[model samples]
Target: MADKEMRAVYAETLTELASKDDRIVVLEADLMRATGTGPFKEKYPDRAVNVGVAEANMLSIAGGMSTEGYIPFAATFGCFATRRAFDQFFLSCAYAGLNVKLVGTDPGVSAAFNGGTHMPFEDLGLVRMVPGIDIVEPSDPVSLKALVQQIAARPNSAYIRLHRKALSPLYPETATFEVGKAKVLRSGTGVTLAALGGLMVHNAVTAAELLAADGISAEVIDVLSLKPLDAETILASARKTGLVISIENHQAHNGLGSAVAELFAEAADRPARLVRMGIQDQFGEVGTEAWLLEKFGLRAEDIAAAVKKALKG
Candidate 1:
Protein backbone atom coordinates (compact mmCIF):
# COMPACT_ATOMS: atom_id res chain seq x y z
CA MET A 1 0.00 0.00 0.00
CA ALA A 2 0.97 3.67 -0.33
CA ASP A 3 1.76 6.15 2.42
CA LYS A 4 -0.64 9.03 3.12
CA GLU A 5 -0.20 12.28 5.04
CA MET A 6 -2.03 11.92 8.37
CA ARG A 7 -1.93 15.62 9.30
CA ALA A 8 -3.25 16.62 5.90
CA VAL A 9 -6.01 14.08 6.20
CA TYR A 10 -6.78 15.46 9.66
CA ALA A 11 -7.05 18.98 8.32
CA GLU A 12 -9.29 17.84 5.47
CA THR A 13 -11.43 15.67 7.71
CA LEU A 14 -11.95 18.41 10.29
CA THR A 15 -12.88 20.90 7.62
CA GLU A 16 -15.54 18.53 6.31
CA LEU A 17 -16.90 17.93 9.81
CA ALA A 18 -17.03 21.64 10.59
CA SER A 19 -19.10 22.26 7.48
CA LYS A 20 -21.79 19.88 8.64
CA ASP A 21 -21.76 20.80 12.33
CA ASP A 22 -21.75 24.43 13.23
CA ARG A 23 -20.92 23.49 16.82
CA ILE A 24 -17.50 22.29 15.68
CA VAL A 25 -14.71 24.90 16.11
CA VAL A 26 -10.90 24.74 16.01
CA LEU A 27 -8.19 26.37 18.18
CA GLU A 28 -4.49 26.46 17.40
CA ALA A 29 -1.53 27.86 19.34
CA ASP A 30 -0.07 29.74 16.33
CA LEU A 31 1.38 26.51 14.85
CA MET A 32 -1.48 26.02 12.46
CA ARG A 33 0.72 25.01 9.52
CA ALA A 34 2.78 22.56 11.54
CA THR A 35 -0.25 20.95 13.20
CA GLY A 36 -2.32 20.92 9.95
CA THR A 37 -5.10 23.31 10.97
CA GLY A 38 -4.35 26.02 8.41
CA PRO A 39 -7.02 24.83 6.01
CA PHE A 40 -9.60 24.75 8.72
CA LYS A 41 -8.68 28.32 9.54
CA GLU A 42 -9.00 29.32 5.91
CA LYS A 43 -12.29 27.50 5.37
CA TYR A 44 -13.95 28.57 8.60
CA PRO A 45 -12.34 31.83 9.59
CA ASP A 46 -15.09 32.63 12.03
CA ARG A 47 -14.75 29.30 13.83
CA ALA A 48 -10.92 29.18 13.83
CA VAL A 49 -9.05 30.81 16.72
CA ASN A 50 -5.27 31.16 16.81
CA VAL A 51 -3.99 31.95 20.31
CA GLY A 52 -0.44 32.93 19.27
CA VAL A 53 1.94 30.48 20.99
CA ALA A 54 -0.05 30.42 24.20
CA GLU A 55 -1.13 26.82 24.66
CA ALA A 56 -2.55 27.31 28.14
CA ASN A 57 -4.71 30.18 26.97
CA MET A 58 -5.78 28.19 23.94
CA LEU A 59 -6.90 25.28 26.11
CA SER A 60 -8.71 27.61 28.51
CA ILE A 61 -10.45 29.25 25.59
CA ALA A 62 -11.46 25.85 24.25
CA GLY A 63 -12.87 24.95 27.65
CA GLY A 64 -14.84 28.16 27.69
CA MET A 65 -16.14 27.53 24.18
CA SER A 66 -17.14 24.00 25.09
CA THR A 67 -19.30 25.40 27.88
CA GLU A 68 -21.17 27.45 25.30
CA GLY A 69 -22.18 24.29 23.40
CA TYR A 70 -19.35 24.49 20.85
CA ILE A 71 -17.17 21.46 20.13
CA PRO A 72 -13.64 22.94 20.23
CA PHE A 73 -10.53 21.13 19.00
CA ALA A 74 -7.32 22.64 20.33
CA ALA A 75 -4.19 21.79 18.31
CA THR A 76 -0.54 22.20 19.33
CA PHE A 77 2.74 20.34 19.71
CA GLY A 78 2.42 17.34 22.05
CA CYS A 79 4.84 18.65 24.67
CA PHE A 80 2.97 21.90 25.12
CA ALA A 81 -0.45 20.30 25.07
CA THR A 82 0.24 17.92 27.93
CA ARG A 83 2.94 19.66 29.98
CA ARG A 84 2.45 23.34 29.43
CA ALA A 85 -1.33 23.34 29.55
CA PHE A 86 -1.98 20.30 31.70
CA ASP A 87 -3.52 22.28 34.56
CA GLN A 88 -6.05 24.10 32.37
CA PHE A 89 -6.98 21.02 30.35
CA PHE A 90 -7.52 18.83 33.38
CA LEU A 91 -9.35 21.28 35.60
CA SER A 92 -11.26 23.23 32.97
CA CYS A 93 -12.37 20.59 30.49
CA ALA A 94 -11.96 17.05 31.79
CA TYR A 95 -12.93 17.90 35.34
CA ALA A 96 -15.98 19.75 34.10
CA GLY A 97 -16.74 16.98 31.59
CA LEU A 98 -16.86 19.42 28.71
CA ASN A 99 -16.85 18.39 25.05
CA VAL A 100 -13.33 19.58 24.22
CA LYS A 101 -10.98 17.73 21.90
CA LEU A 102 -7.24 18.34 22.28
CA VAL A 103 -5.03 17.33 19.34
CA GLY A 104 -1.33 16.86 20.09
CA THR A 105 0.79 16.54 16.97
CA ASP A 106 4.24 14.97 16.44
CA PRO A 107 4.02 12.70 19.47
CA GLY A 108 7.31 11.08 20.56
CA VAL A 109 9.84 10.45 17.78
CA SER A 110 7.47 11.74 15.17
CA ALA A 111 8.79 15.17 16.14
CA ALA A 112 11.92 14.15 14.24
CA PHE A 113 14.80 16.69 14.24
CA ASN A 114 12.87 19.03 16.53
CA GLY A 115 15.07 17.94 19.47
CA GLY A 116 14.25 17.14 23.10
CA THR A 117 12.23 20.17 24.07
CA HIS A 118 9.63 19.66 21.37
CA MET A 119 9.39 15.89 21.77
CA PRO A 120 6.83 14.45 24.17
CA PHE A 121 7.35 10.87 25.37
CA GLU A 122 5.02 11.16 28.36
CA ASP A 123 1.99 13.03 27.07
CA LEU A 124 -0.25 9.96 27.21
CA GLY A 125 0.76 9.29 30.79
CA LEU A 126 0.16 12.93 31.71
CA VAL A 127 -3.26 12.97 30.08
CA ARG A 128 -4.19 9.58 31.53
CA MET A 129 -3.85 10.95 35.05
CA VAL A 130 -6.96 13.03 34.50
CA PRO A 131 -10.12 11.02 35.06
CA GLY A 132 -12.64 10.39 32.26
CA ILE A 133 -10.36 11.57 29.44
CA ASP A 134 -10.47 9.47 26.26
CA ILE A 135 -7.10 8.98 24.51
CA VAL A 136 -6.49 7.69 20.96
CA GLU A 137 -3.73 7.39 18.39
CA PRO A 138 -4.43 6.63 14.74
CA SER A 139 -2.10 4.13 13.04
CA ASP A 140 -2.90 5.18 9.49
CA PRO A 141 -4.68 7.76 7.38
CA VAL A 142 -8.03 5.99 7.33
CA SER A 143 -8.29 5.65 11.10
CA LEU A 144 -7.13 9.25 11.51
CA LYS A 145 -10.01 10.45 9.36
CA ALA A 146 -12.61 8.29 11.07
CA LEU A 147 -11.50 8.93 14.66
CA VAL A 148 -11.26 12.69 14.19
CA GLN A 149 -14.97 12.68 13.39
CA GLN A 150 -15.76 10.06 15.99
CA ILE A 151 -14.06 11.84 18.92
CA ALA A 152 -15.71 15.15 18.10
CA ALA A 153 -19.18 13.64 18.11
CA ARG A 154 -18.76 12.30 21.61
CA PRO A 155 -19.99 14.34 24.57
CA ASN A 156 -16.81 14.20 26.66
CA SER A 157 -13.20 15.42 26.56
CA ALA A 158 -10.58 13.60 24.42
CA TYR A 159 -6.87 13.71 23.53
CA ILE A 160 -5.47 12.57 20.18
CA ARG A 161 -1.78 11.66 19.79
CA LEU A 162 -1.13 12.57 16.18
CA HIS A 163 1.80 11.96 13.86
CA ARG A 164 2.08 14.86 11.46
CA LYS A 165 3.87 13.09 8.64
CA ALA A 166 2.61 10.52 6.16
CA LEU A 167 2.51 6.93 7.31
CA SER A 168 2.09 3.55 5.65
CA PRO A 169 -1.58 2.66 5.48
CA LEU A 170 -2.51 -0.08 7.94
CA TYR A 171 -6.17 -0.49 6.98
CA PRO A 172 -8.45 -0.27 4.00
CA GLU A 173 -10.25 3.02 3.28
CA THR A 174 -13.56 1.47 4.33
CA ALA A 175 -12.28 0.08 7.61
CA THR A 176 -14.38 1.39 10.48
CA PHE A 177 -13.46 1.71 14.17
CA GLU A 178 -15.00 2.19 17.60
CA VAL A 179 -13.49 3.91 20.65
CA GLY A 180 -12.08 1.59 23.35
CA LYS A 181 -11.40 -1.20 20.84
CA ALA A 182 -8.27 -2.89 19.50
CA LYS A 183 -7.73 -4.11 15.95
CA VAL A 184 -6.10 -7.47 15.54
CA LEU A 185 -4.09 -7.16 12.36
CA ARG A 186 -2.48 -10.60 12.55
CA SER A 187 -3.31 -13.67 14.66
CA GLY A 188 -0.95 -16.31 15.96
CA THR A 189 -0.64 -18.80 18.81
CA GLY A 190 2.73 -18.02 20.35
CA VAL A 191 3.05 -14.33 21.23
CA THR A 192 0.81 -11.28 21.11
CA LEU A 193 2.33 -7.88 20.18
CA ALA A 194 0.18 -4.96 21.25
CA ALA A 195 1.32 -1.57 19.87
CA LEU A 196 0.16 2.00 20.06
CA GLY A 197 0.43 5.06 17.80
CA GLY A 198 2.19 5.41 14.43
CA LEU A 199 5.66 3.89 14.73
CA MET A 200 5.06 0.97 17.12
CA VAL A 201 1.95 -0.26 15.34
CA HIS A 202 3.81 -0.54 12.03
CA ASN A 203 6.88 -1.98 13.74
CA ALA A 204 4.83 -4.64 15.55
CA VAL A 205 3.43 -5.86 12.26
CA THR A 206 6.92 -6.19 10.83
CA ALA A 207 8.11 -7.91 14.01
CA ALA A 208 5.39 -10.50 13.62
CA GLU A 209 6.56 -11.19 10.09
CA LEU A 210 10.12 -11.68 11.34
CA LEU A 211 8.95 -13.98 14.13
CA ALA A 212 7.00 -16.09 11.61
CA ALA A 213 10.12 -16.64 9.52
CA ASP A 214 11.93 -17.87 12.62
CA GLY A 215 9.18 -20.43 13.38
CA ILE A 216 7.67 -18.18 16.07
CA SER A 217 4.02 -17.27 15.81
CA ALA A 218 3.17 -13.71 16.89
CA GLU A 219 -0.14 -11.91 17.05
CA VAL A 220 -0.19 -8.18 16.13
CA ILE A 221 -2.72 -5.78 17.63
CA ASP A 222 -3.11 -2.06 16.90
CA VAL A 223 -4.08 -0.50 20.20
CA LEU A 224 -5.43 2.75 18.86
CA SER A 225 -7.29 3.65 21.99
CA LEU A 226 -5.01 3.86 25.02
CA LYS A 227 -7.57 4.90 27.67
CA PRO A 228 -10.72 2.81 27.99
CA LEU A 229 -8.52 0.06 26.50
CA ASP A 230 -10.01 -2.94 24.74
CA ALA A 231 -9.36 -5.15 27.73
CA GLU A 232 -11.57 -7.98 26.50
CA THR A 233 -9.74 -8.35 23.18
CA ILE A 234 -6.33 -8.00 24.81
CA LEU A 235 -7.19 -10.48 27.62
CA ALA A 236 -8.55 -12.99 25.13
CA SER A 237 -5.42 -12.74 22.97
CA ALA A 238 -3.09 -13.02 25.97
CA ARG A 239 -4.96 -16.06 27.35
CA LYS A 240 -4.63 -17.76 23.99
CA THR A 241 -1.02 -16.81 23.24
CA GLY A 242 0.34 -16.99 26.83
CA LEU A 243 2.66 -14.02 26.19
CA VAL A 244 2.24 -10.32 25.37
CA ILE A 245 4.74 -7.64 24.31
CA SER A 246 3.56 -4.05 24.32
CA ILE A 247 5.25 -1.68 21.86
CA GLU A 248 4.88 2.07 22.14
CA ASN A 249 6.50 5.34 20.96
CA HIS A 250 6.18 6.86 24.43
CA GLN A 251 7.61 6.00 27.84
CA ALA A 252 6.98 2.43 28.99
CA HIS A 253 5.46 3.56 32.29
CA ASN A 254 1.79 4.62 32.30
CA GLY A 255 1.43 3.92 28.59
CA LEU A 256 0.54 0.94 26.41
CA GLY A 257 2.73 -1.43 28.41
CA SER A 258 1.33 -0.28 31.75
CA ALA A 259 -2.23 -0.48 30.44
CA VAL A 260 -1.76 -4.10 29.34
CA ALA A 261 -0.08 -4.94 32.65
CA GLU A 262 -3.02 -3.49 34.58
CA LEU A 263 -5.47 -5.58 32.55
CA PHE A 264 -3.59 -8.84 33.09
CA ALA A 265 -3.11 -8.10 36.76
CA GLU A 266 -6.80 -7.41 37.31
CA ALA A 267 -7.99 -10.50 35.44
CA ALA A 268 -5.97 -12.81 37.76
CA ASP A 269 -4.84 -16.44 37.24
CA ARG A 270 -3.77 -15.72 33.67
CA PRO A 271 -0.35 -17.23 33.05
CA ALA A 272 0.86 -14.67 30.52
CA ARG A 273 4.15 -12.75 30.60
CA LEU A 274 4.36 -9.14 29.38
CA VAL A 275 7.49 -7.47 28.06
CA ARG A 276 7.37 -3.74 27.40
CA MET A 277 9.40 -2.21 24.56
CA GLY A 278 9.60 1.57 24.64
CA ILE A 279 11.66 4.61 25.67
CA GLN A 280 13.34 3.65 28.94
CA ASP A 281 12.85 6.86 30.95
CA GLN A 282 15.05 8.86 28.60
CA PHE A 283 14.21 12.14 26.91
CA GLY A 284 13.98 12.28 23.12
CA GLU A 285 16.97 13.57 21.20
CA VAL A 286 17.49 15.25 17.84
CA GLY A 287 17.51 12.55 15.17
CA THR A 288 15.68 11.11 12.21
CA GLU A 289 12.80 8.73 12.86
CA ALA A 290 14.93 5.73 11.89
CA TRP A 291 17.85 6.81 14.10
CA LEU A 292 15.56 7.44 17.06
CA LEU A 293 13.95 4.03 16.68
CA GLU A 294 17.35 2.37 16.78
CA LYS A 295 18.60 4.58 19.60
CA PHE A 296 15.57 3.81 21.78
CA GLY A 297 15.52 0.08 20.89
CA LEU A 298 12.13 0.49 19.21
CA ARG A 299 12.93 -1.12 15.88
CA ALA A 300 11.08 -4.10 14.43
CA GLU A 301 14.03 -6.37 15.24
CA ASP A 302 13.93 -5.08 18.82
CA ILE A 303 10.26 -6.01 19.07
CA ALA A 304 10.98 -9.42 17.58
CA ALA A 305 13.79 -9.98 20.06
CA ALA A 306 11.51 -8.99 22.93
CA VAL A 307 8.93 -11.48 21.74
CA LYS A 308 11.56 -14.22 21.59
CA LYS A 309 12.71 -13.39 25.12
CA ALA A 310 9.16 -13.40 26.42
CA LEU A 311 8.58 -16.78 24.77
CA LYS A 312 11.66 -18.25 26.43
CA GLY A 313 11.01 -16.86 29.93
Candidate 2:
Protein backbone atom coordinates (compact mmCIF):
# COMPACT_ATOMS: atom_id res chain seq x y z
CA MET A 1 0.00 0.00 0.00
CA ALA A 2 1.29 3.45 -0.85
CA ASP A 3 1.19 6.49 1.40
CA LYS A 4 -2.25 7.85 0.53
CA GLU A 5 -4.69 9.89 2.57
CA MET A 6 -8.44 10.35 2.00
CA ARG A 7 -8.10 14.14 1.64
CA ALA A 8 -5.08 13.79 -0.68
CA VAL A 9 -6.95 11.36 -2.89
CA TYR A 10 -9.96 13.72 -3.03
CA ALA A 11 -7.67 16.60 -4.09
CA GLU A 12 -6.00 14.51 -6.80
CA THR A 13 -9.26 13.12 -8.18
CA LEU A 14 -11.05 16.51 -8.22
CA THR A 15 -8.05 18.08 -9.94
CA GLU A 16 -8.03 15.33 -12.56
CA LEU A 17 -11.76 15.67 -13.13
CA ALA A 18 -11.47 19.46 -13.51
CA SER A 19 -8.74 19.00 -16.12
CA LYS A 20 -11.08 17.16 -18.49
CA ASP A 21 -14.47 18.67 -17.71
CA ASP A 22 -14.88 22.40 -18.10
CA ARG A 23 -18.40 22.43 -16.64
CA ILE A 24 -17.21 20.80 -13.43
CA VAL A 25 -17.11 23.71 -10.99
CA VAL A 26 -15.99 23.46 -7.34
CA LEU A 27 -17.55 25.50 -4.50
CA GLU A 28 -15.67 25.48 -1.21
CA ALA A 29 -17.00 27.15 1.97
CA ASP A 30 -13.64 28.59 3.00
CA LEU A 31 -12.26 25.06 3.37
CA MET A 32 -10.17 24.68 0.24
CA ARG A 33 -7.02 24.07 2.24
CA ALA A 34 -8.67 22.09 5.05
CA THR A 35 -10.59 19.74 2.74
CA GLY A 36 -7.53 19.19 0.48
CA THR A 37 -8.87 21.36 -2.34
CA GLY A 38 -5.80 23.62 -2.36
CA PRO A 39 -4.24 21.80 -5.31
CA PHE A 40 -7.44 21.87 -7.31
CA LYS A 41 -7.91 25.58 -6.60
CA GLU A 42 -4.31 26.32 -7.51
CA LYS A 43 -4.60 24.38 -10.76
CA TYR A 44 -8.14 25.36 -11.76
CA PRO A 45 -8.44 28.75 -10.13
CA ASP A 46 -11.10 29.84 -12.56
CA ARG A 47 -13.26 26.74 -12.04
CA ALA A 48 -13.08 26.62 -8.22
CA VAL A 49 -15.24 29.06 -6.24
CA ASN A 50 -14.26 29.89 -2.64
CA VAL A 51 -17.49 31.09 -1.04
CA GLY A 52 -16.33 32.07 2.43
CA VAL A 53 -17.99 30.50 5.51
CA ALA A 54 -21.56 30.54 4.21
CA GLU A 55 -22.50 26.88 3.66
CA ALA A 56 -26.23 27.54 3.22
CA ASN A 57 -25.55 30.11 0.53
CA MET A 58 -22.98 27.82 -1.07
CA LEU A 59 -25.56 25.02 -1.43
CA SER A 60 -28.08 27.40 -2.98
CA ILE A 61 -25.47 28.75 -5.40
CA ALA A 62 -24.30 25.25 -6.27
CA GLY A 63 -27.88 24.10 -6.78
CA GLY A 64 -28.46 26.99 -9.15
CA MET A 65 -25.29 26.18 -11.06
CA SER A 66 -26.23 22.50 -11.24
CA THR A 67 -29.62 23.41 -12.68
CA GLU A 68 -27.81 25.23 -15.49
CA GLY A 69 -25.92 22.15 -16.78
CA TYR A 70 -22.87 22.77 -14.58
CA ILE A 71 -21.75 19.93 -12.28
CA PRO A 72 -20.98 21.50 -8.90
CA PHE A 73 -18.93 19.93 -6.12
CA ALA A 74 -19.60 21.73 -2.83
CA ALA A 75 -17.07 21.15 -0.03
CA THR A 76 -17.48 22.01 3.65
CA PHE A 77 -17.39 20.51 7.16
CA GLY A 78 -19.95 17.78 7.96
CA CYS A 79 -21.76 19.88 10.58
CA PHE A 80 -22.35 22.70 8.11
CA ALA A 81 -23.28 20.38 5.30
CA THR A 82 -26.01 18.48 7.21
CA ARG A 83 -27.11 20.87 9.97
CA ARG A 84 -26.58 24.35 8.53
CA ALA A 85 -27.52 23.75 4.90
CA PHE A 86 -29.84 20.76 5.19
CA ASP A 87 -32.94 22.50 3.88
CA GLN A 88 -30.98 23.83 0.92
CA PHE A 89 -29.78 20.33 0.16
CA PHE A 90 -33.27 18.83 0.53
CA LEU A 91 -35.28 21.36 -1.49
CA SER A 92 -32.79 22.93 -3.90
CA CYS A 93 -30.52 19.97 -4.71
CA ALA A 94 -32.06 16.57 -3.87
CA TYR A 95 -35.73 17.36 -4.31
CA ALA A 96 -35.06 18.76 -7.77
CA GLY A 97 -32.53 16.00 -8.61
CA LEU A 98 -29.82 18.56 -9.28
CA ASN A 99 -26.38 17.21 -10.19
CA VAL A 100 -24.69 18.43 -7.02
CA LYS A 101 -22.00 16.62 -5.08
CA LEU A 102 -21.94 17.64 -1.41
CA VAL A 103 -18.58 16.86 0.18
CA GLY A 104 -18.67 16.67 4.02
CA THR A 105 -15.27 16.72 5.72
CA ASP A 106 -14.37 15.75 9.33
CA PRO A 107 -17.24 13.29 9.84
CA GLY A 108 -17.72 11.36 13.10
CA VAL A 109 -14.73 10.96 15.46
CA SER A 110 -12.36 12.14 12.78
CA ALA A 111 -13.12 15.70 13.87
CA ALA A 112 -10.62 15.09 16.72
CA PHE A 113 -9.46 18.47 18.10
CA ASN A 114 -12.43 20.23 16.51
CA GLY A 115 -14.55 18.79 19.39
CA GLY A 116 -18.23 17.78 19.46
CA THR A 117 -19.43 20.94 17.74
CA HIS A 118 -17.50 19.92 14.61
CA MET A 119 -18.06 16.15 14.68
CA PRO A 120 -21.03 14.89 12.65
CA PHE A 121 -22.32 11.64 14.13
CA GLU A 122 -25.68 11.86 12.39
CA ASP A 123 -24.68 13.21 8.99
CA LEU A 124 -25.15 9.91 7.18
CA GLY A 125 -28.52 9.26 8.80
CA LEU A 126 -29.57 12.84 8.11
CA VAL A 127 -28.51 12.74 4.46
CA ARG A 128 -29.93 9.26 3.87
CA MET A 129 -33.42 10.48 4.62
CA VAL A 130 -33.36 12.96 1.74
CA PRO A 131 -35.16 11.68 -1.32
CA GLY A 132 -33.06 11.12 -4.49
CA ILE A 133 -29.81 11.69 -2.60
CA ASP A 134 -26.93 9.21 -2.43
CA ILE A 135 -24.96 8.77 0.81
CA VAL A 136 -21.36 7.51 0.71
CA GLU A 137 -18.39 7.24 3.10
CA PRO A 138 -15.25 5.91 1.44
CA SER A 139 -13.11 3.54 3.56
CA ASP A 140 -9.69 4.68 2.38
CA PRO A 141 -7.76 6.68 -0.22
CA VAL A 142 -8.09 4.11 -2.99
CA SER A 143 -11.84 3.82 -2.44
CA LEU A 144 -12.11 7.59 -2.06
CA LYS A 145 -10.51 8.13 -5.47
CA ALA A 146 -12.81 5.57 -7.05
CA LEU A 147 -15.86 7.22 -5.41
CA VAL A 148 -14.89 10.70 -6.66
CA GLN A 149 -14.53 9.43 -10.22
CA GLN A 150 -17.79 7.46 -9.93
CA ILE A 151 -19.80 10.47 -8.67
CA ALA A 152 -18.26 12.68 -11.36
CA ALA A 153 -19.26 10.30 -14.13
CA ARG A 154 -22.76 9.66 -12.74
CA PRO A 155 -24.29 13.11 -12.35
CA ASN A 156 -26.71 12.84 -9.42
CA SER A 157 -27.27 14.55 -6.08
CA ALA A 158 -24.92 12.90 -3.55
CA TYR A 159 -23.33 13.48 -0.14
CA ILE A 160 -19.76 12.16 0.25
CA ARG A 161 -18.51 12.29 3.86
CA LEU A 162 -14.75 12.49 4.48
CA HIS A 163 -12.39 12.49 7.45
CA ARG A 164 -10.63 15.71 8.51
CA LYS A 165 -7.25 13.90 8.54
CA ALA A 166 -5.81 10.95 6.63
CA LEU A 167 -6.22 7.34 7.68
CA SER A 168 -3.57 4.61 7.29
CA PRO A 169 -3.48 2.82 3.98
CA LEU A 170 -5.13 -0.59 4.42
CA TYR A 171 -6.48 -1.76 1.07
CA PRO A 172 -4.55 -2.68 -2.04
CA GLU A 173 -4.22 -0.14 -4.85
CA THR A 174 -5.89 -2.62 -7.19
CA ALA A 175 -8.97 -2.96 -5.00
CA THR A 176 -12.08 -2.18 -7.00
CA PHE A 177 -14.73 0.11 -5.43
CA GLU A 178 -18.26 0.13 -6.81
CA VAL A 179 -21.07 2.39 -5.67
CA GLY A 180 -24.00 0.61 -3.96
CA LYS A 181 -21.89 -2.51 -3.45
CA ALA A 182 -20.20 -4.19 -0.49
CA LYS A 183 -16.80 -5.86 -0.76
CA VAL A 184 -16.01 -9.06 1.08
CA LEU A 185 -12.52 -8.57 2.47
CA ARG A 186 -12.32 -11.89 4.29
CA SER A 187 -14.41 -15.10 4.37
CA GLY A 188 -15.51 -17.32 7.20
CA THR A 189 -18.49 -19.34 8.43
CA GLY A 190 -18.66 -18.68 12.15
CA VAL A 191 -19.36 -14.96 12.48
CA THR A 192 -19.58 -11.93 10.18
CA LEU A 193 -18.35 -8.38 10.83
CA ALA A 194 -19.65 -5.62 8.58
CA ALA A 195 -18.04 -2.19 8.93
CA LEU A 196 -18.13 1.16 7.17
CA GLY A 197 -15.78 4.09 6.56
CA GLY A 198 -12.14 3.93 7.88
CA LEU A 199 -13.22 1.57 10.66
CA MET A 200 -13.74 -1.25 8.14
CA VAL A 201 -10.07 -2.06 7.83
CA HIS A 202 -9.54 -1.91 11.60
CA ASN A 203 -12.49 -4.19 12.37
CA ALA A 204 -11.49 -6.68 9.66
CA VAL A 205 -7.90 -6.98 10.92
CA THR A 206 -8.99 -7.36 14.52
CA ALA A 207 -11.62 -9.97 13.64
CA ALA A 208 -9.04 -11.96 11.71
CA GLU A 209 -6.69 -12.02 14.70
CA LEU A 210 -9.48 -12.84 17.18
CA LEU A 211 -10.81 -15.66 15.00
CA ALA A 212 -7.35 -17.10 14.63
CA ALA A 213 -6.88 -17.18 18.41
CA ASP A 214 -10.28 -18.73 19.12
CA GLY A 215 -10.20 -21.09 16.10
CA ILE A 216 -13.55 -19.62 15.02
CA SER A 217 -13.43 -18.13 11.56
CA ALA A 218 -15.01 -14.70 10.99
CA GLU A 219 -16.00 -13.00 7.72
CA VAL A 220 -15.35 -9.31 7.04
CA ILE A 221 -17.39 -7.13 4.71
CA ASP A 222 -16.94 -3.43 3.93
CA VAL A 223 -20.17 -1.48 3.46
CA LEU A 224 -18.79 1.32 1.31
CA SER A 225 -22.05 2.98 0.35
CA LEU A 226 -24.32 3.79 3.30
CA LYS A 227 -27.58 4.47 1.46
CA PRO A 228 -28.52 2.09 -1.38
CA LEU A 229 -26.65 -0.50 0.66
CA ASP A 230 -25.44 -3.78 -0.79
CA ALA A 231 -28.16 -5.91 0.75
CA GLU A 232 -27.27 -8.96 -1.30
CA THR A 233 -23.81 -9.30 0.22
CA ILE A 234 -25.11 -8.57 3.71
CA LEU A 235 -27.84 -11.22 3.51
CA ALA A 236 -25.40 -13.73 2.11
CA SER A 237 -22.98 -13.15 4.99
CA ALA A 238 -25.76 -13.38 7.54
CA ARG A 239 -27.01 -16.64 6.06
CA LYS A 240 -23.50 -18.08 6.14
CA THR A 241 -22.37 -16.86 9.57
CA GLY A 242 -25.67 -16.76 11.57
CA LEU A 243 -24.01 -14.06 13.73
CA VAL A 244 -23.39 -10.46 12.63
CA ILE A 245 -21.79 -7.40 14.20
CA SER A 246 -21.72 -3.99 12.56
CA ILE A 247 -18.93 -1.53 13.45
CA GLU A 248 -18.95 2.18 12.69
CA ASN A 249 -17.65 5.53 13.95
CA HIS A 250 -21.13 7.05 13.98
CA GLN A 251 -24.03 6.45 16.34
CA ALA A 252 -25.63 3.00 16.55
CA HIS A 253 -28.98 4.13 15.17
CA ASN A 254 -29.75 5.03 11.52
CA GLY A 255 -26.16 4.37 10.43
CA LEU A 256 -24.40 1.19 9.33
CA GLY A 257 -25.78 -0.85 12.22
CA SER A 258 -29.38 0.15 11.65
CA ALA A 259 -29.09 -0.30 7.91
CA VAL A 260 -27.73 -3.84 8.27
CA ALA A 261 -30.28 -4.76 10.90
CA GLU A 262 -33.16 -3.73 8.69
CA LEU A 263 -31.82 -5.79 5.79
CA PHE A 264 -31.18 -8.95 7.81
CA ALA A 265 -34.47 -8.73 9.61
CA GLU A 266 -36.38 -8.76 6.33
CA ALA A 267 -34.31 -11.15 4.21
CA ALA A 268 -32.65 -13.72 6.41
CA ASP A 269 -35.04 -16.58 7.26
CA ARG A 270 -33.08 -17.28 10.45
CA PRO A 271 -31.93 -13.82 11.32
CA ALA A 272 -28.41 -13.61 12.69
CA ARG A 273 -27.79 -12.32 16.21
CA LEU A 274 -26.70 -8.76 15.54
CA VAL A 275 -24.85 -6.27 17.74
CA ARG A 276 -24.11 -2.65 16.88
CA MET A 277 -20.84 -1.16 18.15
CA GLY A 278 -20.43 2.62 18.01
CA ILE A 279 -21.02 5.79 19.95
CA GLN A 280 -24.16 5.49 22.04
CA ASP A 281 -26.91 8.13 22.04
CA GLN A 282 -24.72 10.94 23.42
CA PHE A 283 -22.64 13.86 22.30
CA GLY A 284 -18.87 13.84 22.01
CA GLU A 285 -16.56 16.05 24.07
CA VAL A 286 -13.24 17.84 23.48
CA GLY A 287 -10.52 15.16 23.29
CA THR A 288 -8.04 13.47 21.01
CA GLU A 289 -9.42 11.12 18.36
CA ALA A 290 -7.89 8.08 20.05
CA TRP A 291 -9.37 8.99 23.42
CA LEU A 292 -12.78 9.61 21.87
CA LEU A 293 -12.77 6.29 20.02
CA GLU A 294 -11.87 4.45 23.22
CA LYS A 295 -14.46 6.37 25.23
CA PHE A 296 -17.18 5.45 22.74
CA GLY A 297 -16.08 1.80 22.45
CA LEU A 298 -14.85 2.09 18.85
CA ARG A 299 -11.45 0.50 19.42
CA ALA A 300 -10.43 -2.73 17.68
CA GLU A 301 -10.70 -4.54 21.03
CA ASP A 302 -14.25 -3.27 21.35
CA ILE A 303 -15.10 -4.62 17.91
CA ALA A 304 -13.64 -7.99 18.85
CA ALA A 305 -15.64 -7.97 22.05
CA ALA A 306 -18.86 -7.25 20.21
CA VAL A 307 -18.16 -10.11 17.82
CA LYS A 308 -17.46 -12.39 20.78
CA LYS A 309 -20.73 -11.39 22.37
CA ALA A 310 -22.59 -12.17 19.18
CA LEU A 311 -20.86 -15.55 19.02
CA LYS A 312 -21.80 -16.33 22.63
CA GLY A 313 -25.44 -15.55 21.98
TM-score of 1: 0.98
How far residue 194's Cα lies from its native spot in candidate 1, in Å, is 0.1
| True-structure RMSD, every candidate | 1.0, 1.4
Mind giving the per-residue lDDT tens digits that candidate 1 earns over 210-262?
Answer: 99999998999999999889998898899899888889999999888898888
Q: Which ten residues in a row have the lowest lDDT in candidate 1?
A: 263-272
Q: Which candidate is the best by TM-score?
A: 1
- For 1-313, candidate 2 gives per-residue lDDT tens digits of 5656778888888889888988888899988888878888888888899889899999999999998898999989898999899999988898888889999988788788889998888888788888776778888777888888888888789999886466666678888788898888788888888888875556566767777697878888878888789988988898888888888888889888899888877763866878887778988677888888888888877777777776676
Candidate 1: stretches off by over 4 Å: none
> What is the Å distance of residue 131 in model 1 from its true position?
0.9
Position 233, candidate 2: lDDT: 91
Clashing pairs in 1: none
